[model samples]
Target chain A: MISNKQILLLTSLLIFSAASILFSLLSGSVDITLAEIAGSILSAETNLNSQVLHQIRIPRIQAAFVTGGLLALSGAIMQVLLRNPLADPYILGISGGAAVGALSAILLGASGFWLSNAAFAGALFSIFLVFGIANKFGDWSVTRLLLTGVVVSAGWGAVINILLTTSSTNNVQSMLFWLMGDLSQSRVNLAHYLLLIAGLAGGLLLSRSLNVFIRGELLAVSLGVNVQALRLLLFFSASVFTATAVTIAGSVGFVGLIVPHMLRLLGARDHRFLIPSCILLGGSFLVLADSLARTIVAPQQLPVGVVTAVIGVPAFILILRSTIRK
Target chain B: MATLHIQSLTLEVAKKTLCRDLNLQIQQNESWCLLGRNGAGKTTLLHSLIKQRVIDEGSVLLDGTDIADLKQRELARKIGILFQQGIEALPATVFETVMLGRHPHLQSLLLDNEKDIEIAEQALAVFELDSLKARPVDTLSGGELQRLALALLLAQAPEIFLLDEPSNHLDVAFQIKLLTVLTDKVREASASLIMATHDINLASRFCDNIILLLEGGEALVGKCSDVLTEENLSKAYGCPIQSVHSGEHRLFYPA
Candidate 1:
């Protein structure tokens, strides 16, 4: 039954998404008009204004969209994979894994490729560790999985702290800043790579399996779903999506944990709708948050991570309240 | 036509032999009821047939094909079993829970097709669960969920139905309703059904044959009238028993 409410919500989300994209393009530090954005795309543009609009601001906008979309997608998938509403990339220990990797690179004086590499490696390692510990205890119990994650996260956090303390002040500042998250250094090419590979692979492969999964494990298995294989695939896909988000935007939190639940609350539980909705809404939310961070105190940019938390916390609470009321 | 042959099947768990040298054959359209007191291995034997528990010796064959040769999916298509108070992980809708029975028939990525829906709908209608199709299964009453579970088994459309205490947690009306539906399904599909039940009367009224499980892995397998005797019931249940028979129906009760 395709209700009118569903149609209305979908249409409004789309309209809001278009408006948010347009608004993000217009509200950067070096202001560019809507016409200029269009003109920059249309023209064979090499002029200063066109260069700023096309080369710098456009890439940043795209990066924000990709990162935001992925984090939310990961969150939604994690919820179903873990069989808990509170589950997200962070709760599944991906954030801790990525954080460990990013912190290690910073401590080691690594730059460029080493940063993203360390982040990805750390994320995968953490997931594998949690999977191993949980599996070792016989069945894949949810409590055991989360508890193991909590323990590992504590250990990883302690290690990151030790590394930070032992490092020079300059290194510490950069490490701390990355931990807080930033969007200033985002590259279009890297964002494109992360979005295309992780998004397509995770979204397509897992979406169908997720429908089976949401029905519950026994039913999923009875339906010829290989539970073990699917869980591993889900962990790997979500880890990759999460790690890429961290590497690009530097550990933007809560978006990966919150947005998917919002989509579910809005009556889009089917993965086909949920997967895309998370992607679009996540990207849009981050781009808007990033724009506000850049311009809220113009000429003195706040970290996008800080902006996200500030906006995300209140909005998350609002969503939570509305969800509970419903 | 389907035939299940258990030849000298024995099951031992934790160094305790629950059943030993159990030879039985259930052919197409046959219905068998297992009557026993608690801990008599009726449940264990039922579980063994589904491979949920290992058989210590011999083989279980469907149509002379050993169960070991058939993969789980293929075997599932031929046999559907329901456990009492089965696991429910989430609040799955009645339609979705029933649709899960179609899993063995589905391909990797293809969504549920018209045939699958038709089968699910028919199963739902058979158990009078069509109105509750969209309702969350967890919200269902025990009797309703039991009916829904039966609908799920019907959706599988297996040749053999193995039930363990299928009447548990059901009211008298639901119990009678379940027995009637099961009997109707067996008749219409020409399917073999084996149910392990505590109610001797229910078994005598509905079953074509009865297996009386006594203590220490001993059992008497024969017609319902022969197996449901007071002597066997007293020996099996460790209690004085009597039989009441009127017309074609016979019932056993503790004296």
Candidate 2:
């Protein structure tokens, strides 16, 4: 049973997330009022303000929330899977691999959906490569897995540099935009939201097993968990989540590394509560960050990753200090 | 009736031979101690018996069936193990951590039910961990952590127990206290124990059988008195050991 304190904290985060979404909808470079946004939703009108709200802000905000949520959840799983605090969704090189696939597709004259699909394929390929190397001796050790992923990520980094170097200047600009993470370019697709929700539910379902896993391999196996299978599932799940988020917003960093630790500080270490809480906190955090990104510079629009990294670093340090003090 | 039979088992770890052509049978109600020096492969051999480590040759039969054929969950239900060391920290309270012992018995992945809670609380009360129940595992001292791990193993209540130095970090009184619980389990004849340890006195006092594991995968296996001879103990330990007998009690000390 969840404690009263946990319920209170979760409910508060929900309110904050909802407030951020509303804030994102109402406040942007385009001065869309709350009334206009609400009227557009209620009446399905197509005026200028309503058009901006429905056509751009809504999808962008929703997608930002989802991508952020996905990254944070994936990071939490990675930390547990490898039993390393420094682990993040990108540590296994899924994002690096996705970036390679995406940049290569752009180089090959692929645009829009095709590029994203190629990115996912690349992420899947990295997942298989890491697993193959880690499971070579039939022992999927966390240390070995971590080492394999880090090396693969480095390999992907070299490939990405090669692609960037050889590509034309025209493609370089778009490639850089993708590399820095841009949620504004993502279409308002229901599939992304649906996939995010499904993955979160699956992760929460696996939370108890995760709790045992985070404790260590010996305890997990002694408790009858199939550690190898669970490890594989966690790796793939995190990779898939990373693939989707990277496809949507290039590679939003810091959110994955920061948000889950913040939630842990908030006493949401249990995976059942932790995964769901990450969705709320991470989604709200990104929505707020994206709003600041577009408005803080007034129409120039900094990359969402830059905004997240800027805000997330300070917030994480503060939380870390508070946790240490406690 | 529950028996663990090792048939011509060969095991190796890190290019070191742990056991070669090893055959042994341990039945319910028999308490055995695996005595060995460091790197003697006691840990590796115990792991091999539980099928946690891959065997070079032969099979371990649980009751009448090969352990390889048994499902993981089924094996967990039949066997419980305690590691020498625990996670440096866990986010759970002692109550929550110990309650995890109900994991294998749990009908599903949900947290403890009424019965599991009852078992956990009973174990806590028996082990006298009430004061520390609400504390996080990291706050526990060495002895406390060992007791907590032991309590978790007891609450699991499997048919077989394979403990790797379960007494490490435990205070002398608590050591005897926990060992008495294992002795009681032996009396009930519902579970068997195979404990690896360096304490020959404790083994001589409690074990029905003793196995002295020497270097290079050779083991002197027999009853406590038979295998506790000065010659075998000295040879296995690579040290001169003399057995001093006082009344019915036997103690071996360095000569």
Candidate 3:
């Protein structure tokens, strides 16, 4: 099952991710020379270059990569759980609900970490709403569950629209930009990194269960997996992941929807390989995309979400074409 | 001892009564056929044994153990079923798909043992799926998938087999081939089989016992020869039925 082609792709993806991290630390409004970068790494820091490298760029790059990996892995889990190719980490309205919560908190004069907490709460709320609605009478048919998610997501979208319309005009521009997804002020804290790492490991550990669960509930049950319990566990874990991603960088859309799918195209069918590959590829994809967003126009920044779709679409098409050929 | 015993079972589906006060026992080494027309409660009755649909009025015992008392894993190891339409777009290969039958017996959560692989390989070869072993289940045809499913069930190595419309999409040649293989397997293991199929010739060819389920929960259950008569089939199907002898075999058809 471990083809050399897969090994090569995996190795290349890992190298690309590492390289992206290094380049992200280097390329920004304040460009540190290669010598300065090396000197900072070699020695201690009294210089502003090292300060920017460690405090600003390092954590920002880490946060961006973690968010990307979390979203992509979560999206992959959701796709199999819902059995819909279009299912994403935010398909259950987690991001939409997060947006509403974050926006409302901002409207109420909450800033900084509180806004992210509120967004996380909103994601939890959405997860509970969807779970409750679908678990009614124990009917967890894929179509019903999918329809419920879409409808709830639409409801959250309407609430977001209303919040935008009702908010004071002064806060409107900033909120709109945040809604479009900006990570410039995102908290690149230690806890966020730990959570992402733990989530990735947990996903790998559960990948075998996912392999059975993905096929269908009946088969999962037949295989002695408690399908209902596994479903709840996957749904909530993915919700938490989407919450983390949205809390970090607003809604970086296509990384979640596209990275795992692209990995699948490269013959990473088993979840054991698929989940970890998603971690590596997703981290590289968004880090590179965010780097482009920061340096595309220099000094003036676009939201990374915008850059993500633009980069993801054509890359996905090429991958799709290659996969179809195979 | 009976492999499966259903006691006074009452089942209802979508406001229609599928069975009521139904009692049956399937002994080890026996192959039983559920002979009935569409909606004759063949599927509903069979599913109750696996705890898919809970019966309100009675209990199904597996080796004198109440099915409700057994956990999912133990029950799965004891009784395996092939549904009418299994997962078609499963991402696993035929080998992997068949290997999944080892799940109930797997001691670890992540990996399968070589014995599990050996058993799966044997089942795949017997079911004629060895050539498609590496192909993903999604890429398989209906007949191929059917054979793969049967191989998977066989790999499970359950004591009781419940096959619902097991030959729905199979060609005649494959149907005979698969059943002939299965017959030999069950005899060797002294396991029991309960198959719900529309093909009467298949029942006459393999089954030792047959149940003719009539409307209103009236059932005629006995030896295959005694219960699968034209009068009972016509009454159950609500149509004219005639029995014919083709040399050494018996076949039933609509008149």
Candidate 2 residue lDDT tens string, B1-255? 568998998888877788888889998888899999998888888777656777888999998899888876677878888887754566678887886677777545544477888888877876788889889898888888888888887777788888898779878888888889867865675789888998988888888898788888888888987788899988988999998888999888999
Name the lDDT value of residue B170 in candidate 1.
Answer: 84
Cα RMSD for candidates in order: 3.5, 2.3, 2.3
Q: What TM-score does structure 3 among the candidates reach?
A: 0.94
Deviation in Å, model 3, residue A38 alpha carbon: 4.7
lDDT by residue for model 1 (A187-227), tens? 65764665655675667556656776786665555444567
Give the CA lDDT, 0 to 100, for residue B182 in model 2: 68
How many backbone overlaps does candidate 1 show? 1
Q: By lDDT, rank the candidates, best first.
A: 2, 3, 1
Residues A189-307 of candidate 2: C-alpha lDDT, one tens digit per residue: 77878878887888877887787777778777887777878888888888888888998889888889888999998788778789888988888999999998888888688888899
Q: Please give the DockQ score of every candidate, comma-separated.
A: 0.33, 0.48, 0.45
| Candidate 3 per-residue lDDT over residues A1-326, each given as its tens digit | 34576678888889999899878877998978889988998998668889988887777788788889899889899998888899998888888888888899889998888988888888888888887898897767667778888999999999998988998997787677677677778757777778778887888778777777777777777666777677778888888888888988887778889998898888787787888889898888888888888899888998888898898899999989987887
lDDT of 1 by residue, B83-195 (tens): 76553735557887787777667544535577888899999998899999888776888778888878888888888988888888788888998789888987799998998
DockQ of model 1 vs. true complex: 0.33
